[model samples]
Target: MSRILVVEDNIGIRNVLEKTLKMKGYDVFSVGTGENAVRLFTSDIFDLVITDLRLPKMDGLEVLKKVKKISSTTIVIIMTAYGTIENAIEAMKSGAYDYILKPFSLEEIEIKVEKALSQQRISNENIILKEEIKSRFGWITGKSQKAQKVYKFIKKVSDRPTPVLILGESGTGKELVAREIHENSSRRNFPFVAVNCAALAEGVLESELFGHERGAFTGAHAQKKGRFEIADKGTLFLDEIGDLPLNTQVKLLRFLQEKSFERVGGTNTLKVDARIIAATNKDLKEAIKNKSFREDLFYRLNVITMTLPPLRERREDIPELIDHFWSRYTKELHKDMAITPEVKDILYSYDWPGNIRELENAIERIIVLSEDKVVSIDDLPMELREGISDIIPKALPDNIGFTERVEYFERDIIKQALEKCSYNQIKTSERLKLNRGTLQYKMKKYNLYCKKISTKS
Candidate 1:
């Protein structure tokens, strides 16, 4: 149930508010002073706070400020008497959700509280959705040496104003890296705008980047701020930068060099302080060799470069990635399922040609389509199960050294499991019947870092 705290100096008002809120099926806590209200807020998880504007010793505005400091997400509603309109408005400015005037009907307060709680619920849901979307990328799921190296690189360059170019294969989480850089950087407070160069045609891409003045093109009816302008004092991410046309590249290069540009068919030059972050699945050197990409532009963006390793290389991270996905999707899909050892063996044995993205899709498919809570071999797609058998040889030579062969097999199996789970140690240990400490030791011994699992272009 939603928790609401009622803070009023008057005993009668506090009792009435608490009783009314309790009748509405909310968990209510009542306090007779602002100090006691703050104490309750710190001691418990409250969804909403109703405070009287004129409290003895401390006022509602102070309570709102303190509550915000404690939990920025908590909603605060101010209660004031009819001639205290100025104080109520001041409360709103100080982060109050809404104000209730004295002599208010219980029904009116109920409706207001309901609306405030509903809004808070929506806000919380949005935060969860964003975290879910962010976690879908493989780069966010590991602490392996390779992942740590990449993390350190991101941290080092995130503060710099230089352009960053992330090179990674499809589904290798280039965007995730871009976001991490932005989030850790000084520009984090501002918008982190993203554009896909390969997704848009040259003409449209040009307009999208530089925007256009009114009547600049057939459909340009009014002035439009480009991505750079919209992302001023923030980070602008250009995905698939290798596909940008030469003409657009020239324009982009100029923007990078001068930090200013003119809109299409417009004379006024606008300056933007947006940090540039670009990503591409294609090799820029090859693109430059083919004369498809400009050398100067490549050099500009490559100031700080980070490459993501493919899933095949970092097979050790799969098990962790899979477990992370399972934990997330189990809650999302409302299923309490466990991945079986046999199924894990199958996953580790197979070669993931499609990488981390493909593995996540396969897991989601099993979670949704499986009839039982336990995901067995039968739950997997036929191709994956078949591929596993083909990849693991059916016979072993008697002449071969047993210890050496077993060690090799164990290493390979562990590597694949890690890759399947996305380098999550808890999941990897669960899959391998080992503790987290043992798994960490084995990963170190094998020289396996999570970054090896997903290929960065």
Candidate 2:
């Protein structure tokens, strides 16, 4: 239920407000003085505060300021006369939601209360959405040395508003890192607008970047604000930047140099303070050599270059990545699924040329189609299972029970991880998401070093 606090010095007016709001299904609390209203507010939470402009000891404006200081999100409504209407405006400037005149009807006050609560609801929802964005895209999860370096660089450059050029293979999460940078940066509360430079046509691309003036073209009947202007005081992410046309590249170079640009077919030059973050899969230097991309723009964007390693190069992080995707998709798909040890081995062995994106999609697909609790080799894509059918040999003893069988599989998974890390115990433990002492104990129990590792790279 929405709670409202009514602060009126007139006892008759206070009783009428309290009775009317309560009849309207609001939990209304009435007080005769602003001091009592503030005291009650400090003790309990109220969604809306309706206060009289004139009060004894402390004024309604004072109560509004004190309540705002305690909770900036609290909604405050000022009630005043025409003579003191200016004071109500000043109270609103100090964060009062709205004002109700002294001769206001019950319906008028009800409408004001409803509007204030509605706005407050929207404000609360936005807070939740922002927190969700921070929770989902704020962290870059990996323990590999390469991933650690990316973390350090994100933290290092988050405070500065410099151009960041991210170079990586497709699906290597260049945009994810860009979001990480924005979410951790000082401008996190502002917008993080992204545009695909390669997706739009050359004609549309210019307008998309710098906007178009009214009557600029046949279809452009209205003025449109571009990504740069929309992302002012925030971050603008330009994806697939290597595919930009030469004409657009020239205009982009000018924007980078001058931090200003004129609308297409418009003479007025506009400046926007948008921090630029560009990402691409193509070899930009090669494109420059071929006269496809501009070298000057390249140098401007390369001021802070962050290169993301492909999944194949960061092999040790695969298992944890699989877990990350698996956990996410299973919950989203509402599937009680468990990946088999054999499937994990196959996934860890496959070379993900498409990088993290491919692996993430594969996990989601498996969970979607899977009906049983256990995700076996048959649940995976055919290409993922091919050329690796003979991955783990069929050496489990036929007499072994389920408990012994689980033990046998666990040992092999540990052994495979150990071999991948060149038998480095610390690296193996980290790759397997285990502590060094626990891994050592398991290795000893499984007699991993008793027999030589097989000839498997």
Candidate 3:
């Protein structure tokens, strides 16, 4: 239920308002003074605050300001008398949601309150939707301590109107992080344009960034807007930023500093208000040292830097990622398939040099090619199968008993299968050829049951 705070000096009015709101199924709190309202606000969380403009100790505007400082998300409404129209406007300027005039009917106040609460709900729902989209496609997925710290940093820098530089390995999903930052920011409603600097030659890259006028060059038969121009009032993501030519870098630097640029063969300068988010898989610091990149432009784009960890470093997240990909491609490919214990064991033991992208592609391929309802070792690519075999040592110590060694291998395989299936006992049992009861017994024997498993299924 939504919580509402009613602050009115008139006892009769406060009682009527509180009774009406409570009868309407709202969690309501009533206070007679602005000071008491502020006290209650600090002590608890309230979704909406309705205050009288004229109060004994602190005025309604003062109370609104204090409540906003405590929680900017809290909605505030001001109530005033007929002659206090000026004070009501002041309350709005001080961040009030709406004003209710004195002698208003109970139904009128209820309507205003309902409207305010509805607006607040919509705002909160929009925030949640954006977060969901960011998590789904943004690529950086994890709740580990390291991953949480990176998410916090991205949240902090996302709202700032400045250039962001992301550094990571080739398959580390730097572009995904850039997209997440843009999606969570003020530019979310605008275009999120991306360009690859490494894929284009100097002349082509220049033309792509700053569009050309008609007849400006050999192929410039028609006028075109640049990526920056297209992304005006939005976000421009420049991938492989380190590969930008020196001359293009200078032009980019000027745009970053002044937010103005000129197209090829055009003298008139076009201004843009786009945010720049650049990503590079190269070591830009070394590039600067080698004089391959311009130092001034590097500084301008490096205002906020984020580094994504490679998939090998966060191996624990692979199982979750597999599940995520399965949920995605299963619908796309119309397959009711699942990965088997043997398949998962091979996946976990192998070092992922290509990171998340490689894993996603592998999953997609398995979904497309697997004939049975489940994926097994035979479904995996030959290269991955060989990679797993090459990493295992053929011989064991002579002192170790064969039975004990086999049990140890079984335990490892079971553990990997459970992790890959996200601890779905039914699926794990099916993959391991054990009944659910037998799997549970072994899980308890191996102490695997001590770990917390998600109950999503």
Report lDDT (CA) for all predictions: 0.87, 0.87, 0.86
Worst 10 residues of 2 by lDDT: 131-140
Clashing residue pairs in all predictions, respectively, total 38, 0, 0
Ranked by lDDT from best down, the candidates are 2, 1, 3
Clashing pairs in 2: none
Model 2 residue runs over 4 Å out of place are 1-139, 395-457
Q: Judged by TM-score relative to the true structure, which candidate is superior, 1 or 2? A: 1
Cα lDDT of model 1 by residue, 1-457, tens digit: 9999999888987898899899889999998988998888888899999989999888888999999999998999998999998999988998898998888998899999999999999998989967865687767787667777777888899999999989878887788888988989988889999999999989999899999999998989999989999999999999999999999999999999999999988999899999999999998999999999999999888888889877776666777888888898888899999998678767766667777788888888899999897887778998887775533535567788988788777777788778767888898898678988988898898887866455766
User: Could you list the CA RMSD of all candidates, in the order they appear?
Assistant: 9.6, 8.3, 14.3
lDDT of 1 at 371: 81
Error of 2 at 1 (Å): 19
- Please name the candidate that would achieve the greatest TM-score relative to the true structure: 1
Question: What TM-score should be assigned to candidate 2?
Answer: 0.64
